[model samples]
Target: MINTRKKLITYLRKRDGIKPSLQATLVNIRCKLPDVVIFGGMVRDFGLGVRHFSSDIDMVTTASAEQIRHALAGLNPVMNKFGGFRFRENGRLFDIWSLQDTWAIREGHAQAKYLSDLCRTTFFNLDAVIFDVHALKVRARHGYDEDLQRRVLDINLEANPNPRQMAIRAVRMAIQKDLQLAPALVEYVLEQLYGTSLNLTYQSYVRQLHDHTGRTPESAFRFEPQLKIW
Candidate 1:
């Protein structure tokens, strides 16, 4: 784990290299909040060396909303409905929030009381990872390291409110990372594959997302699964 953690830092530095703006923003947050840490997908990307450039990142701090607003006043952070503050740096979104207001914890899907607890609230195994920006350390739960190593997607939580988005993101990650879907994940995606009040098929929506994001490699578009109709 120690070696893997070191490798994550190494990858972030060498591959897609961290941007100066992001570095400065993190430093500023640490200086003000002290308890802030970067968590979720960014950590997963760094650990697996999957990037061509740095972009948006999610961070969590134990500070109160007023404190966070005051601390980030220079950035003019805009509060999202979920209580997260968003500000742009070099055109990249910085999603910082109080640890106490994480959607999973606030919605009673998970419980957390510290920075590390943030790792337990992700929707996918690969995303259940956190990076301690100040200490340069990594922590994770829900088979994050194992699944990331094997390049598989598995469910970390199944009771979330956005299964449709979850299913779409699962497909996108499988394409972007060349991952195989765990049975549980596959079942969930199959169940939520179609959107409500729309005639779009799963493949169509995925294609649209692929085109819009332009992040998934063209070669990875090989997911043509056969369904077993009941």
Candidate 2:
């Protein structure tokens, strides 16, 4: 596994646009909410050494939504149904989720336990990897770092797995990270797409395809580079 502290610092240093603002924001949040940790796409892309212009950052904290809102009062955060707060600063979006109010607890999949347990229950693939700002350490479930190094796409099937969402995200990540899906994983995603009746509309898929490829929806779906099953 990579040294989480060094890699995180390096990642932040590389982002000249948001580094100073992000550092200041993190310091302020940590001062008030000592248990908040950064995670999700930012850390994932950092680990993979992929550079992309991202406007949002995701974090989880032990503090309540109200506490977080109060702590970040200057930003004027708005609370959402998912028990998270969204705010913008310097043209960047910050999404902070209360650890006590995650969907896993509401859905009865897991209890509100340790940060490690919460990290394990996160989304499938490399997105589950988390960076604890306080400890300056990385928390990843089994095979997470290996998947990152290998550029393989696999889902955490045991923890409230949403195949449809995973399938879409997998395609996006594959394109973003220049990754290839494992044979079995590709087969599984295809099965999930063909077998289940997902609420995701055809128009959504068309939009996503168009976003990824500049071609018309018909041509995009027919020959999208990201969906090439390896």
Candidate 3:
């Protein structure tokens, strides 16, 4: 297995592709926001790869439904006008979705309790970070902290999806980010949750998605890369 720490460093190198300092700074300033966290793909990167990058990152903060709506009031002059937080600049999109801690916690824990084939995630795009205003600390939620409490909190939070659904979404995103190139991880998750392989149709769709989203032609064509044959 790849040393998780090494993979994390690699991801950091690639994540430099897009400068997120502005967003990071904004999040830092908005630390007072309740249960505020920088989650999604960026955060997922820490658990999965050493170097990764993504244009979009999702931020989840602990605020009342109303408070979240108010905090993200000014996403973009027009985006706000359109009643959404999706903004596109230079052909890339950024999204900010805030959820109350109650909602987030209702869904699941923020850290992984154990690294089983089911709960363990070994692929990501862009390292994810959490700026906890309450704690007054910015932590690498997915990196090689080597400490259980620090590294595994809860699985990524989702509004209306279960672990299986989230795993599929994560696999797709990882392919898009070029962080993982095999089906093993996906199968691992499926087995853990579903106790079987993905149905033919689902498998085909995943393959197609990977073909279009993965790093290279070969990587997409061959789910099992030479380096990570399983």
Q: Give me the candidate number with maximum TM-score.
A: 1
Span of ten consecutive residues with least summed lDDT in model 1? 221-230
Identify the candidate with maximal lDDT.
Answer: 1
Q: List the RMSD of every prediction in angstroms.
A: 7.3, 7.3, 10.3
For model 2, how many clashes?
Answer: 0
Q: Give lDDT tens digits, candidate 1, residues 1-230.
A: 46557765665454224446355657778999968888787777766675443667888988987889999998889998777999986567889988888888888888888888877788888888888878888888846667777777778777777788888788777766667676666656656763444333456544443443344432223344332111
| Candidate models: Cα lDDT each | 0.71, 0.66, 0.41
**Rank order (by lDDT, best first):** 1, 2, 3
- lDDT value, residue 147 of candidate 3: 26
Off by over 4 Å in 3: 1-35, 46-52, 76-92, 97-104, 107-129, 132-136, 140-144, 147-164, 167-223, 226-230
- Give TM per candidate: 0.78, 0.75, 0.42
TM-score of 1: 0.78
Candidate 2 structure quality by residue, lDDT tens digits, 40-119: 67777777775443758888888877788889998899986566888887667888988877767657776766666665
> By summed lDDT, which 10 consecutive residues of candidate 2 come out lowest?
214-223
* lDDT, residue 189, candidate 3: 42
